[model samples]
Target: MKIGKSKNLRVGEWVVAIGSPFQLRFSVTSGIVSAKGRSIPNGSDSTYVPFIQTDVAINPGNSGGPLFNLEGEVIGINSQIYTRSGGYMGVSFAIPIDYAMDVADQLKENGYVARGWLGVSIQEVTSELAEALGMEVPKGALISQIIADSPAENSGLKEEDVILFFDGEEIFYSADLPLTVGAIRPDSKVNAMVLRDGLKKTITVTVGELPKDPALAFNETQQNFLGLVVEDQINDGRRLYIEGVMVTSIDPEGLAYESGIRRGDIVYSLGRAKISNVNEFKEILSSLDQEKSTTIGISRNGNKRILSLNLSK
Candidate 1:
């Protein structure tokens, strides 16, 4: 069977799906590609699969069916639907043939799938965040945190670095990074272009093997001060590393909570003192004057801003 390149797929282009929905064998449905590079959240994280979204009537039995282009070439595999009533609701997603073929080749060769890892927690670059980062346009994957003892850390990749390209290919979105990196073999060296502090720089990194178990729960330790419970953002064997202190919970009646401090906010700087970890955050709190307002720097959703709080009693 002839295969079509998903890279050539254009939005609004007509496509077809052949599947057995509700026991109806070999049912054919038609639709146009609605979107691309959509990131669907998976638990505390998200899958970077560049799904080809369509309005095709896909149902339970339609999964694993081939999606074809007008030329009768296979372009994708019908995988999921965005329905709320356990049936099709005008939205369906397909796995791009490009990615599916890569997985198939790996499974056929080694009987297992092995993906490359870059050891960085990334976020999308919004327009507001791009302006703050001195970027003319919002693009690329913004590095929010780097995993310790990983390829990113070893290659000197730091927080706030915007990964513009991987292996000479431009990263159109944050989700594109994982899709590109996963296709690479482990131990392979690749050059990445990143925007650091408003300047572009190239760094070479050796990709590592994706761990068999990648999900690690964050072990939060509570320390109450100013009505906020702060803890180190630690998730052993995972990529949930964040500098400064993470707010696990906030007491509604506490000063910090009343001052608009919310849970999940990472306090990077207290007043003028920069916080590098949980200990520093504690030390800064202990030495505070408690008689004046203080400003704290926080990185939330890739946008850095200051929050003022009346710490005085």
Candidate 2:
């Protein structure tokens, strides 16, 4: 069967799904491509699968069935559905034929898929975060953490770097990075464009092979004397471009809470020190003078503001 070019499929384009949903044989459904490059949350991290979303009626038995264009060319494979109930909810996802074919070829050759890996964790960029980072628009994946001894670390990809392009393809969302990186052959060098400190730069990286078990370990609580409870924004399971300490709770009568800092405030910078994570927040707080007023940069609900706190009072 001829395979359609999924890359050419655009939103609102007509498509068809042929499958055996709920044990019914040769069922056919028609729909339009609803969206692309969607990132869905998976456990602690998210999977960067550029799914072709459709209103196609795909159900439990429809997985692995071909999704075709009007020309009878296969464009995708019905893979998942978005539903609160155990039935179709007008939203279904298909693995793009390009990606699926790549995996199929690799598995047929080596009995397993060898996906290229870049050792980094990333999150999506929000409009508020873009302004805070001096970016004119919210695009690309924001590197939240770099794994030690990984290709990203070896290539000098640092935390807070916004990866704009990978191998000449623009990454419109954070999820696009993994989809692009995973399709490459391991040990191949590729060019990447990244925005660092509001400046655009290009770097080369030698992609590594995916580890059998890739896991990120984080702690539950941190100890700080600032009378505020903060967590690492990036690792807290929320996809956001701004990296800093997110205030989860505040002591009602404590210095921070009394200084107009409340729950849900993201502390981006304190005085002249930039805060990227909880550790950095604690470090900066350790050096602060208890008798002086301090200036803090915070983003509250997409609005940036400056807060001055008199710790001496």
| Top candidate by TM-score | 2
**TM-score, one value per model:** 0.63, 0.65
Cα-based lDDT for every prediction: 0.76, 0.78
Clash count (model 2, backbone only): 0
**lDDT winner:** 2
Model 2: per-residue Cα lDDT over 169-243, one tens digit each: 799877588778877878999999999988999999898887655322111112244566666554434677676
Q: What are the runs in model 1 whose C-alpha is more than 4 Å off?
A: 44-48, 124-128, 168-175, 215-313
The 10 consecutive residues of candidate 1 with the worst lDDT sum are: 214-223
Model 2: lDDT to the true structure: 0.78
Clashes of 1: 0
RMSD of each: 11.2, 11.0
Model 2 bad stretches (over 4 Å): 44-48, 215-313
